[model samples]
Structures are given as structure tokens and as C-alpha cells.
Target: MTNNLPLTVKRSIELLGLIGLIAVMVIARDIIMPILMAFFISIVLLPIYRFLRNRKVPETLSIVLPILLVAVFVALIVWFFSHQIGILVKDFPQIKENVKQHIDSLSDWISRITNFDDKQQKAFIQDKSDDIMNMATSLAGGAALTLSGVFVFIGLLPIYIYLMLFYKDILLRFVFMWFKADDHPKVKEAIYETESIIKSYLIGLLIQITYMTILLGGILLLIGIKHALLIGVIFAILNLIPYVGALIGNLIGVLLTLTSSQELWPVVTVLGVIALVQFLDNNILMPRIVGSKVKINALFAILGVFIGGSIAGVSGMFLALPIVAVLKIIFDRTTMFKQWGILFGDERPAKSPMSFAKFRRKRNVEVKPGSEKG
Candidate 1:
């Protein structure tokens, strides 16, 4: 009992220490988050840096090229979507009217079924509508603030990326130096694995996004949907959030279609397009591209998304899984953090060859007088 008391006290102290660490992290999150994001972006872009260097490109040029490409790509997307965004903003009044009409129509149908008067129905709906609008406005304001922060980060990204890329080797050496000389080999292995995972995950995601965007855009166009490109791009970007993202995009698409076209068939067709794209992403694209790198289980992936959304909003949600995957890699490599790797790992058990005798011995129980032992 005395010995057990000491063990219990030690565990309580350990738990308190962990809680303190978590509190500190939460408090420092705002300052830490951007640097963490910068680190990850640098990791993701490292492959291109290495590839260019190997091809005898100047180190500075190597870093500049990929950064330029990413910048140009982002600029083109913003330019392409600027008009749609403006139209959407301008059409807010029309959208509100359409939404109100739909709600009134729905309320009427419900009232008819329930024998409620139109005034009662309208009152009920008006309250609900006000709540929804308030929530949406709050969300929109938050999103605007987040985008402003992203723009500020973007301004600094080139400098951060350039220095990180050019000095990657030195950075890696410093990391290795932080460990004992004998531990350098293991540190290098961990570094390589971390780099490989980030590069693979990012590049694969880019390809997946491009394919999904094209497929979704083509399908929407074929179905004669208005603002097909806009819808497709929006879906592609949101799809980065994993399961919930596509669903949200689908809801938005359906709402937009409902407002733009009164035809049920068109809405059904849009839903079908979303379903088909989801199927392709799940069965074909993800399995081939992201499966190898992101081996984290679905539950953790979803949890990560939710936590990230809570902390950093959409950008956090978009980055959650990749960050989790990177953390898993680091944990798996580091002796002290191996338990975290196990905690975050896929829950499936590995199959191993079993000896019949050992299995039988483990399962064996003393036979009772009337019991048969198998």
C-alpha cells in the first residue's frame, strides 16, 4: 500500500505537468501557429527545392521558381474568381429574397400539414431565419478576419520560404547537432521521413485538387449549371477539409442552384455530380495518391479537422490532417513521443503468423468434469 501511494502520487504529478504544458500551448497558440504553418509550408516545398538544386539550378533560383509558380497560380485563381465573388456579393439581396421565398414556401407546406395559420408559420420561420442570419453573419465576419491575416502572412511567405529553402541544409544540420553526435543517423532518418511525408502529402493534394476541380467543373458545365467554374473551384478548395468539406460544398451548391433555378431536376443533377465526384475521390484518387502518406485513421482525421477549425478556422481545418500526419511521423521517430504515435495511429491491428500450439496454449483452460476443451 505504501509503495502504491508513491506511484499514484508520481502519476498525479505527471498528469499535472501535462495539463500545465497544454495550458501553456493554448495560451501561446496565436504566436506559435503562424510559425508552425510557415515550417510546414517550407517542408512541403522542400522537394522542389532539392529537385532544382540537383538539376544545377542556382539555389536562389530554385527557391524562387516554385514560390513564383505558387504565387502565380494563386493570383490566377483569385483573378478568375474575383468577378464571381463580386457578383455573389452584389446579388446578396436577390439571394436573401429567394431564400425567404423558399422558407415561406416550406413553412406553408408544413402549416398545411399541421393545420397551422400562415401568420403563426411566418412568425416561427422569421425567428428561425433571424437566428440563422445572425449566425451566418458572425461566421462571415470571422472568415473575413481570417483572410486578412492570411494576406499578411502571404506578404511575408516569400521571404520565409526563400530563406528556409536556401538554408535547408544548414537548418537540418542544426537539428542534427541538437542531438548527440551518435544520434545524428537517427535524426537524419527522422528528417528524411518527415520531408518525404510532407512533400508527398502536399504534391499529392495538389494533383487531387486539380483533378477534382476539372471533373467537378466539367460535370457542372455538362449539367448546364450557372457559375459552374465558381462552384467547382469552391468545392475543390473546401474539399481540402476532408469529409465535412464536400458535404458543405454540396449544401452550398444545392442552395445556389435552388435559388438560381426552380427546377427540381437541376438540383438533383447537381447533387448527383457531387456524389460522383466524392465517389471518385474516395475510391480512386485518394487511395492512389494520399493513402500511402496519410495513414491516420478517419476518427482522428475528423477530430483534427474539428480542433483545427475551432482554433484557426478554415485554414486550420484544411491543414489539420497533414499537420497531424507530420506529427505522427515525428512521434513515431522520437523515443519520447512514440506513445503519441501509437495514440494517433490507425487502430487496426497487424496480422502476424500464429503458431497453432502457442494459440492453443493461450486459449487452453482446465477442463471441468463435464466440459469439453477445444
Candidate 2:
């Protein structure tokens, strides 16, 4: 009946459905983000759970152990970062002094360019100070809301992971119920491929974080930059969010450099070094590590990140690539959505400089030798 509909009508219906789905996603973003995160994490941890199960571990224990390990690992990262933050806080006085000195230098530079005296500048700032305070007050509220969301996301994550792992069989059954037994082979293959793609993508990301941190931090430290390790780690993790993350990472690294040093050269050096690392990661390391498992092209990847961010903020951005990747795998397997799969995929047109005549001659010559032998 749906197929009998006119193409224009079918497309209109699809467009409506897409709009409705996006609306639902935006409205329930808070509820959705944590579950989505846990789903991906569960995929990443599935192997560990399976390993334990194969060892004849109790079902509950197998589920709980992986969650516990993940919890502990996260706690360690949080603790390490908290220590770094503490050191940062302790240097607030020095940072404040540096800021004042920098401000004075900037003011002097401005005075040289413009006719405004220091007194006028001070008066202008006084006029705007009230607006700044109001802005800060609103920002404080936003910060509190963000904090609450983070707490909710963190608190529910482990619970969701546990439930997902415990009821994975039920979930698999639910998926299988969508098709008849005759389609089971194709369904199972899709599931396996989706699982493979997600696992490889997540693991490759982990490897990326480790090496990016080491290389970026080590290079900055060698160049005598302050907070080199922290900046490196920040960029490494942020770079996980695909195209948008790297740009944000650059902004953050630059901000850190500017705040830490009064010199301009360090900031330039930091940007240069990050660009080099990004070049290496994009061209060499990423392809080797991730392989062809998740071949999402640049356009869709960027659009997905933006769309995901618009729907659910940072969590959405982080989840976007894997979600699209999983969708691509499923779409490629199914008959109806193969066009979407092709759109998401990164298949390039093969090109050869060899002329048709030259190619035919080579093939014919090679075939003639084989024919003679026969």
C-alpha cells in the first residue's frame, strides 16, 4: 500500500516523519542522551562481558564486573583531572596578576592607536560592567543546569549499562521479531556487522586518545609550554567528536596558551603543533586504526555532529558518529534504505591513467600467454 503511493507523496510522508523524529529527540534529549551513551558503552564492553560469560562466570557477576571496571576507570580520570584543576585553582593569584599585566599592555596598545585616554576607557567599562554582571548571573544559572544534567547523566549511565547487558538477549529477540525466520540470516549478519563496526570504532577511538595525548603533550612540553599535558589531554578527548571537536580543541588549546603565557609565539607554536598532529591523525593514523569499518564521509559526519549537537548538546555531538555509523551499517543491509547507505558511505570513483587500448592490450597479452599454456 505504501509502495503504491506516488513518489512525491511518499517523500512528503518521509519528510514529515523526519521532522517528527527530530522533534521527539529534542524534547526528550535529557532522557535520551544517557541511554544512548550507555548503549554505545555497552557495545564497547560487550566483549569483556562475553569473555566472563565464556569462563562460566555468573550472569550477574559478568554484568556487574564490567560496569565496576568502567566506573573505576572513570573515577581515576576524574580524580586525575580534579588534581590538575586544584593546581590550576592554586595558581589563580598568579594568573590574576598575569591578566592584569596583559590588560595593561593591551590598554597601552589601544591608547597608542585610539585617542581614548585611560580615564575614558575606565568610564566605558563602568558603563558596561552592569551588563557584564547580568550576563554572568545568567551564565551561573546555565552552569547550575548543566551541572544537574551531568549528575543525572553520570548517575544513570551505569544503571543503563547494567540493564542493557543483562537484557541483551531480550533486546536481540526484540530485533529478531521485526523480521521472519527467512530473513534471520540477513538480520543476524547486519547485527554482527553493526557490532563489529561499533566495537572497532570505539576501540580505535581509545587508541587515538592515548597516542594523541602522548604526542601532543610531549611535543608541547618539549617546546616549554605550560599545562602542556592538560592541553594535550583536552584536545585528544575533544577530537573524538569528529570534525567539530577538532576545531573546538584548537580554540581551547589556544585559550590555554594565551592564559598561561604573555608571549604570542607560544600560541602560534601550539596551533602549528596541533595542526601537524591533526594532519597526521587524519591522513595516516585514523585510516589505519579505524580501517574501512565505519566509512562515513565528511559531509554527513559534519552534518550529523551539528544535528546531534542541536538535538542534545555535547552528549549528542559525542554520540553522533557511532549512531550514524550503526545506522549506515543497518541501512546498507536493508533493501529500502540502500540509497541512504550509499550517501553515508565513502566509496570513491576508481580512476586509472592507463588508456583503454593500453589496458586491453595488457589484458589480452596476459590472456594470450595463459591460452597458449592451456
Candidate 3:
């Protein structure tokens, strides 16, 4: 139907379809996020599960073992963080005092700037308290909902993962059946590439998290920072999200330092350390480990992250690049969407990003009144 339509009409239909796709994604995010997360996790665990299977382990045991391992690992992290939280709670009085001091300092600065006495300032604040309280209430409500959603998501994840693994063969067959016999080779290649990319990316992430946790945490510990391990682990996990994650990790480190210490130098040191570590990770570690296996350029990776975040919140952002890479791999193998795969790829030495533009301009140049004959 779209093929018979005018160009503009066809484009309009495509645009509407794109909008509808996004709408469905956002509307169904809650239902989709857990399953998608499970899918990725299952992919990462596939090798280990396969290893156990090759050892003649029972199917149920093979699947259950890796899930148990992941659960234990997550439990350890939670336990460690909970212990740190307990320490923070113990220091609540000190933290409260520090916060109040900061607030009072701000109030005094405001008074000097606006020429309002404390009395008038108090009245102004009192007037806005209703609005502020309403906002606080709304935020608290949102927090409760988010917390509940997280628990539900966590609960469903393992179940989804188990089911995905158990039905893996059926799913593969289903995918194969979607294409013709002649296209099976291409489909197999796509599946192989997808699996390779996912495995490499995930393994690299695990290495990154370990390297960062030790590097960052150890440096902070040497510098006598409290909760160094906690800070390091948090930053390491957050740093998984690429450029934006590092910024957030830095903010978190700064906030933790500021809240923990009265001195200014620790904050500076924390920021400096995070910056230096990020520079090393981006320039040296990541390139060596993850490499260009995904072959996505920086531009589209960042764009995908933002778009994914907008569509499905944090889970979307986390999964965006790998998903795009998988899509690119599949698209590149197919005849119809090769152009899209190219757009998602990084500029290589063989193909300059500006080549097409220069070619177009050169081709459009006229003979210039027979000057070219000379």
C-alpha cells in the first residue's frame, strides 16, 4: 500500500509508524523492561550454562546454577551496601548538622543579597512551604512506586531468564522459520555475530567493573576516604552507561565526599581521581577490552543512550548500545537496511565520514563555461 503512495505520503506513513512504535515502547515499558533485561542476562550466562551442560549436568541444574551464582553475587553486593548504609545511618546526626550548616549559610547569603531580614525570609519561606511540601509529598509517592516496581522487576527477572533459557531451541527455530531457506545462511551469520557481540560486550563490562572497583576504591582508601569501597563499587556500576554514567558517578563521588568530610581537599581529590580514572578507562582500558566489536560510533552510541532513556527510563539506557549493535549486525547482513547499518557504524580508514559530502559537491560542479576544457 505504501509503495503505491506518493513519496511524501509514504514518508508520513513511516513517520507515523515510528511514532507508534515509540508509543508502544513507552506505554509497555514496565512489562517489557524485565523481560528484555532477562534476555540480555541469559545471553551473558549462555556460555556458563553451556559449559555445565557439556559436563553432562542436568538441564535444570545447568540453568539453575548460573542463576544461583548471579543471585549470590548480587546478594553480596547488597549486603555490603547495606552495611555501608548502616554506617551512614549511624552518622545521621553529623550529616544532619552538616546539612543544616550548609542551609544556614545559604540563607545568610540570600539575606545579604536580597536585603530581607530573617523575619521576612522566614515569612517568604513559610508562604512557599505548601508548594514545597506538596512537591516533597509527590516525590515521596513516586519513590514508593519506583521502589515497588524495582522489587517486582527483580522478582520477575530470574523467572524470565529461566524460561528464556529453557525455550532457547524453540526460539531459535522460530527465528529461523521467519526467513526462507536461501536466507538461512544470512540469518545464521546474524545470530552468530549477535551472540559474539553480546558475549564480548558483557565480559568486557565485568572486567571493567572489577578493574574500576579496585582502581578507584583502592586509591580513595589510600587517601583515607571513608566508604571507599562503597563509593568505588557504586561508581563502577554506574560507569557502565558510557559518557553520561561517568558524569553521574563523579557527581555521586563528589556528593559522598562532601557529605562525609568538612574539608574541601577531599572533594577536590575525589573529583580529580574520578576524572583521571575515567580518562584512563575511556582511552586505554575500554578500547583494549571491549574494542570495536560492536562497531558503533560515539555519536550514535550517545544518541541511543539518550533515546533509550527517554523511552524506557534507566533500563532502556543501559540496554541501548548493545541492542543497537545487535540491530546493526542484523541490518548489515540484510539487503534492504544496509544503509542504516552504515549510519550506525564508526568511520573507518577505508571510508571517510566526509567522503559522500565531498563526492556530492564535486559531482554537482558544472563545466563552468568550458573552463574545464582548458
Candidate 4:
């Protein structure tokens, strides 16, 4: 035992080194996360670049066209929504009045059931209303700031995207050149898989958002909602956030409906429309598109969202799934990281039916068909 003490000490030192490396990675995550996000976004848009190139479009023009298209679309949306926002802001007092009235009505109903008098109910509400209003004000302020930040980011994004698109081949060569010539095939495979996953996810998300927006907007309009387009677009964008998005959108719709109209049917209709959209999203849209390519399970999907939210807020959450998918592709291609790939993969182990003859056949072991001897 005494003679083996040196080997034990060395093993302990190795274990400590591994833990230290992991700690460093965790600490440096914030610095690395943004670059990772940018890379993944570039990957997602690569197919558009390729499509243009295939059509004999110049590389520079191909890259610029998509970015310009996105910028123009965003500008149009902002221009359209600017009026609605102005109205909402200018009519703040009326909105507040409507909100307060709704709250009072709700409080009355609750107090009746709980046997609290009107005075006590008012007191309870008064204490909480200030906090709620403060929160709402803060959220609105933050959203304004966030919108401005988005425009800034969008302005800068094109530069990065253009560089990535224009120099994509050069970048690929550089990446593969980092390894030996013999390793180029594996590197190419990894790149292809990564690009495929990103493209599939982005396309699927775009299709899903568009369909949900149209469906929800049409339903809300039929139900006589005031701001059907505005609400539908809001829900469609928020739906990108995964599980919490639809619920948040519904809450907003319900509140807006309750305040804008006295009719209970419109509120019910809005709720029903959202429920139908969510059902379609989960059962039909996701399974057909996102589920096939980005095959992450629910537990890891939730974890990814949380991790992403912690690291970069909403942007991180939006990016978490694609980043994980890219990592899964890379890991699956590398022998050193295959176990990580397995952990992330949705594939189940193949199960074989119990049969000695069948097993022998599978193994290519020939045996007499009627032989009973062991």
C-alpha cells in the first residue's frame, strides 16, 4: 500500500485538474456564448447564401440581399406598429382606467366568494396594485430599450453575416486546414451536419411562426378583436420562446380583451384560438419540422432554455436549441466526444427479440436449420 501511494497521488492530481478545467469553462461561458451564437446564426443563414450562389448571384450580392430583405421587413413592421404604439402611449390614462376597472370587477367577484367586504377587498388590491403597476411600467420601459437594442444589433448583424457568407469557403478551408490532410473528410462531415441542423431549425421555425400568426390573427379578427394583427404578430414572435410564450401571449390577450370589450365571448374566443394554435404547434408543426431535425428531449430542452436565459436572457433562450444541435453534431462526429453525443441524442438502443437462431443469423454464424445440439 505504501509503495502504491505515488500512483494514487497522481490520480488524485489528475481528477483535480479535470475539475479545474470544468470550472474555468463555466466561468468563461459568458465570453464564449455570444461568439457561439453568432456562429450558429451564420450557419442558419448559409443555405440562403447557397441558394443565391446556385442561381449565379455574386457572393457579395447574395449575402447583402438576404440581410437587406430582413432589414426591410423589420422596418416595415416597425413602421406599421409605430402608430399602434403611439396610440397606446398617448391613451395611457384611458388604458389605466380600463385596467383598474377590470381589476375592481375581479376583486369584487373574488371578495364575494372569500366573504371579504368591499372595503377590505379595495385595501388588498390597493396594496398590490402599486407593485403591479410599477412592474408593468418597468417592463414597458425595458421593452422599449430592448427594441432599440434589437435595431442596433440588427444593424451590426449584417456586417458579421456578410463576412461569414462571403468568406464561408475560406473559413471552411481554414477550419479543415487546422487538422491534418487525412482529417479533412471528418471535418467536412461535421460542417455539413452542423449546417444542415441549423438550416432545418431556422426554416422550420419561420414556417411555424408564419402559419400560427395567420391562423391566430384570422381567428381573432373573426371574433371582432380590436388589434387582431398586432396581437397575432406579438404572439407569433413570442411563440419562438417555447413553452412559456403561448401562456404569456394568452394572458396579454385576455387582459387586452377584458379591458377593450365588455363581451365575455370575445375573451373566450381569444383563449380558444390560442389553445388551438398551441395544440397545432405541439402536435403538428413541431413534429413535422423541428422535431425531426433538432431532436432534443423535453428535459434537456427546458434545461437549455434556462441556461440560455441565464447567460444571455431572451437571445440566449432563442439560440439554445440550435446551439445544442450543432454541438450534438460535432460531438457525434468525434471519437473523443461520442459519449456526449449519446447523452444529447434522442435515439434509443435497438432492441432485438430473444431467439438464439435469429441472433446467430444476425451474427452471420451459419448453423444447420434443424440442429438441436448445443
Candidate 5:
């Protein structure tokens, strides 16, 4: 009955459905986020699960073993961060002294360049300090809340992954049942492509993180930057979030550098080194490791990152590209959503629809200057 609707009405309905879906996601984020995460993770671990099954491992054992391994990997990352943070804390007094020195120098420069003297600058800082303290307090409280939620999310993740793996066949059957027999082939193709994309993307990310850490950390250490490993690890992790991640990583790297040393050259060295590494990562490392088969255009990718972050915080940001890729797969396979698939893709047409080249090609002849219609 709805097939007879006007084109505008159909588009409006689609827009409304999209809004409804986003609303549902936001409302049930606490429950839905983990399930989505587990779904992607299960895809990443599917090969390991298959390997164990082929070796005659029990289904339960197969699932549990991979989850356990993932847990250990996560635990090791946490330990590394904790150890680095401990060392940072031990250097607190020196960092404080460095910060003081930098601030005095900055104040002196400002006083020399501008009419604002040191006393005025100190007074202005004092005036803003209370507001800064309040903001920090609120952020700390939010962090505490987020931490508890993270714990709950982590506890539920393994169980979700285990069930998804154990019941993979059932899930496959459900997906198949959603479409008619004639469409089963396309449906299967979409499923297979999604699995392949998720697996490759996630595994490539892991490899990217490892190499990024080593490259960034090693370069910084050789340059004698303090807390090089910590900076590397932080940047690698943050750099997971598409375009915005790199900028944030750079800012964090600079801040960390500033905290460690009073000398300006070390900070300059850190920035220059990060820029070089990022150049390598963007041009060489990522493209070669993570194939651009499912390339998302910059516009929607940034929008997805921000929307995901708003809805589900960091996890949303990290998952945005994969989610977009999966949706593109489904959209491309569906008749009603093919346009959306095109919108999400990075491909550019060789010529515009109304371009002279296209026009000449259509007419099978180029128009001479005097051949124009009056």
C-alpha cells in the first residue's frame, strides 16, 4: 500500500525512521552499546573460534578461550598504563617546577610584548582559577561515573561475545529468514562482506596501534623526550578516531611534552616528530595495512564520529567507521537505499553529468565553435 506514496513522502518516512532509530540508540545506549561491541568483536575473533572448533574443541571451550585471551590482552594494556602513570606521578615535583618556569617565562614575554604586566596576568589567572577548579571537579565526577559504567560494560562484554559465537548459526538463520529465498544470495553476500570488513578493520587497527606505539615511542625516546612510551600509547589509542583523533593526539602529545620539560626545543622536537610519524601513518601505514575497499568520505565520517561520540562516548567514536561500512554494505544491497550507499562512499565520477566531456561522449562528436545553436 505504501509503495504508491509520493517520492517526497517516501523520503520523509525514511528520514523519520532514521531519527527514530537514533533516538532508540541514545535511549538504550547503556544496553545496546555492549551488544554492538560484542558483535564486532565476535567477528574479529571468528577465525580463532573456527580454528579451535576444527581442532575438536568444545563449543563452550572455543568461545571461552578466545574471550580469556582478549581479557588478558586488555589487562596487560591496563597494567602498562598504570605503570607509566605511576612513573609520571613520581616525577610530579619536577613537572611542577617545569610548569612554574614555563609560566614565568610566558608571563615575562606577554609583559614585554603587550601592556599587560605580570601583576595583571596573575590577577586574571586567580580570577579564572575558581571556575577552572569547578570544571575540573565536574569532569572528575563524570569520569568516576563513566568508570563504573565501563566496568559493567566490560563484565557483560565477554558473556555477549560467548553467546554470539555459540549461537552463530542461529543468528545466521535469523538473518536468512528476514529475506525471501530469491534474495538469500545477496543477503549472504552482505553478511560475508560485513564479516570480512569488520575482521580486517579490527585486526588492522591492532597492528596499527602496535606499530604506532613502537614508532612514535622509539623516535621520541631517541630524541630524549620524557614519558615517550606513555605519549606513544596515548596517541596510538586516540588516533583510532578518524580525523579528529590525530588532532587530539597532537594536542595531548604537546601538553605532555610541556609538562615534562622547561626547554622549548624539546616541545618543538616532540611536535616535529609526531608530525613526521603521523605523515607516515596516514600515507603509508594505514592504506597498506587497512585496505581502502570500504572507504568512507571525510564529510560523513566526521559527522559519524561526532554523532557516535555524542550518543555513546569514546566507544561510539571508535566504532563509527565500521558501523558506517556495515550500513553501506546493507544499503548497497537494498533497492530502496542504494542512493545512501553512494552518499557514504568515497568514489568520484570521472566527469560531471552536464560536463562538456560527458555531453560530447553522449553525442559521439565534439561541437566546433561555430556549431552552436543560435
Candidate 6:
């Protein structure tokens, strides 16, 4: 029936379908997010699950063991953060004094540059501080609700992962049932590729986090930045959000540095180290470790981050790249969506339509006709 329609109408329908799909995702994000996150995590855990199964381990134990290991890993991280934060809390008076000193310095500089006196500046700051306190109060209320939702999400993840791994055969069959027998090979290929991509990407991220913490925290510690490990952990986790994450991480790093010390040199040092590490990570580490498997372009990657954040907040932002990569895989394999795959990809043509050669050829064509007329 759609084949009988005009091309424009067909395209319009596809666009509308895309919009509807996004709407559904946004509306049902809470239900979908945990399942989606668990699916990716299960893929990363597949090797361990398969290894245990191959060893003739009990089916139940195989699933439970990996999840136990993951839970223990998470517990260690929580312990580390709590310990670090407690130490930080001990320095609260000093940090408050440093902040006050920095604010006074800033206000004095502003007063020197502008006609506004210290009294006017203090009044302005007082007004803004009251607004900030009110905002923080509201955020505290919202944070309680968010915390409850997080617990529920976390509680469901292991169960979802267990079921996914246990009923993996049924899931494969369900997927295969969507297509004819003839297309089974391509479906199998996509499945294999997706598993490989997810495993590589997730494991690469773990490695990234470890080394980033060691590199950033170790250096900051040597330079005497208080709570250096805390800043490192915070940055490594936040840096998962692609382009925006690094910037936010840097900002946080600077703030931590400033709060910990009265000097400005540490803030500069933090920024410089972060910039250097980011350059190395972007150019060398990511390319070699994660590889070109996901090959998404920057434009779509940033757009995906924003769109995912709009739909599902931080988790969505972190998951955006892999999600786009998976979508690109499906789109490339399908007949109707190959163009979208190309759009998401990082591949560049040898020569664009607007290249110098094409421009020169058009000029030659015009000149040739004019020469003949003359």
C-alpha cells in the first residue's frame, strides 16, 4: 500500500513515524531506561556468563556470580566516595574561608574596574546568594524524589540482566521471527556486531575511568590539591557524557581546586592537566581501545547527547553514542534507512559536489562556450 504512494508522502510518513517514536521514548523513559541500560550491561557481561556456562557451572550461579561481582565493585566505589567526602567535610571551615577570600578579591577587582562600590557589589551578591539558596532548597526536595527513583531503577537492573541472559535464546528467536529465513544471516551479523561493539565500548570506558582517576588524581595529589581523588572520580564519571562532559568536569575540577586552596596556581594547573589528558584520550586512547567500530560523526553525536538528555537525562546522555551506533548498524542493514546510516557515520566522500575540481570544471564549461561564441 505504501509503495502506491508518492515519494513525498512516503517520506512524510517516515518522518512522522520517527517523531512518534521519539514521543513514545520520552513518555516512557522511566520504564525503558533501566531495561535499555541492563541490556547493554548484559552484553558486556556475556563473556563471563558464557565462560562460566562453558565450565559446566549451574545456570543460576553463572548469572548470579557476575551480578555479585558487579554489586561488590559498585559497593567499593561508594565506599571510596563516602570516605573521600568525609575527609572533605572536615575541611569545611577552611574551604568557607577560601571561598570568602576569593569572593572578596573578585569584588575588589570589579570595583576597581567599574564605578560600583563594594557596598553595591555586596548587595548584588547578597541578592544572588538568596536566590541560589532558594534554588538549592528546591533542588534538595527534588533530589529526594530522584533518589527514590534511582533506587527502584537500580533494583530492577540485575533482574532484567538475569532474565535477558537466561532467556537469550528466546530473544534471538523473537528477533529472527521478525524477518524471513532468507535475512537471518544479516540479522545474525548485526547481532554479533552489536555485541562486539557494546563489549568493547563499555570495557573501554572502564579502562578509561581507571586510568583517568590514576592520572588526574595522582598528579593533583602530588601538587597538594585537597580531595584530589574525589575530583578525579567525579571527572572520570562525568566525562562519559561526550563533548559537554569534559567541560563540566573541568569546571568542577577548577572549583574543587579553588575551594581546597587559596592560591590560583592550582586552578590553572588543574585546567592544564585536564586539557592535556583530554587531548591524549581523544587522539590516542579512544582510537586504539574503543576503535572505529561505532564511527559516529560529531554532529550527530552531540545531537544525540542533547536529544537523549531531553528524553532521559544523564543516563541517556552517557548512552547516546552507543545507541546511535546501534541505530546506525540497523539502518545500514535495512533497505529503507541506509541514508540515515550514512548520515550518522563518520565516512567522508573522496570528492564532494562542491569540491575544487567540480568548481573548476563548471568554470571551464562556461569559458569553453564563450570562446566558441567569440
Candidate RMSDs in order: 7.4, 7.0, 6.6, 8.0, 5.8, 6.9
Candidate 6: RMSD to truth = 6.9
TM-score against truth, every candidate: 0.80, 0.88, 0.85, 0.77, 0.93, 0.93
lDDT of 2 by residue, 77-158 (tens): 7887888778778878777777677777888998999998898887887889888998999899889989998998999999
lDDT of 4 at 106: 81
Model 3 pairs whose backbones collide: none
* Winning model by lDDT: 5
Candidate 3's residue-wise lDDT over 250-314, tens digit each? 88888777777776788898888888888888878887887676678789999999999998888
Please report, as a residue range, the 10-residue window in candidate 3 with the lowest summed lDDT. 365-374
Q: TM-score of model 5 relative to the true fold?
A: 0.93
**What are the clashing pairs of model 1?**
none
Candidate 1 per-residue lDDT over residues 264-314, each given as its tens digit: 687898889988988888877777785465377678889988877776667
lDDT tens digits, residue span 1-374, model 4: 32355756855765687578546646775545545555666776676777998999987888888878767876887886797667557767766777777777888798778988888887877889899999998899889987886666655666777777777779878898788888788888888777777877877887877888789988888868867777787888788876666677888888777766655787888888888888887877767776475466557777877777776677777887887788777767765456556556555333333544453221223424432111
- Candidate 4 residue pairs that clash: none
**Model 6 lDDT at residue 137:** 96
Give the whole-model CA lDDT for all candidates, comma-separated.
0.75, 0.84, 0.83, 0.72, 0.89, 0.88
Question: In model 4, what is the error at residue 275, expressed in angstroms?
Answer: 1.7
Better of 1 and 5 by lDDT: 5
Instruction: Estimate the lDDT of model 5.
Output: 0.89
Measured with C-alpha atoms, the lDDT of residue 371 in candidate 1 is 23
| Candidate 5: 10-residue stretch with minimal lDDT | 365-374
Model 2 weakest lDDT span, ten residues long:
365-374
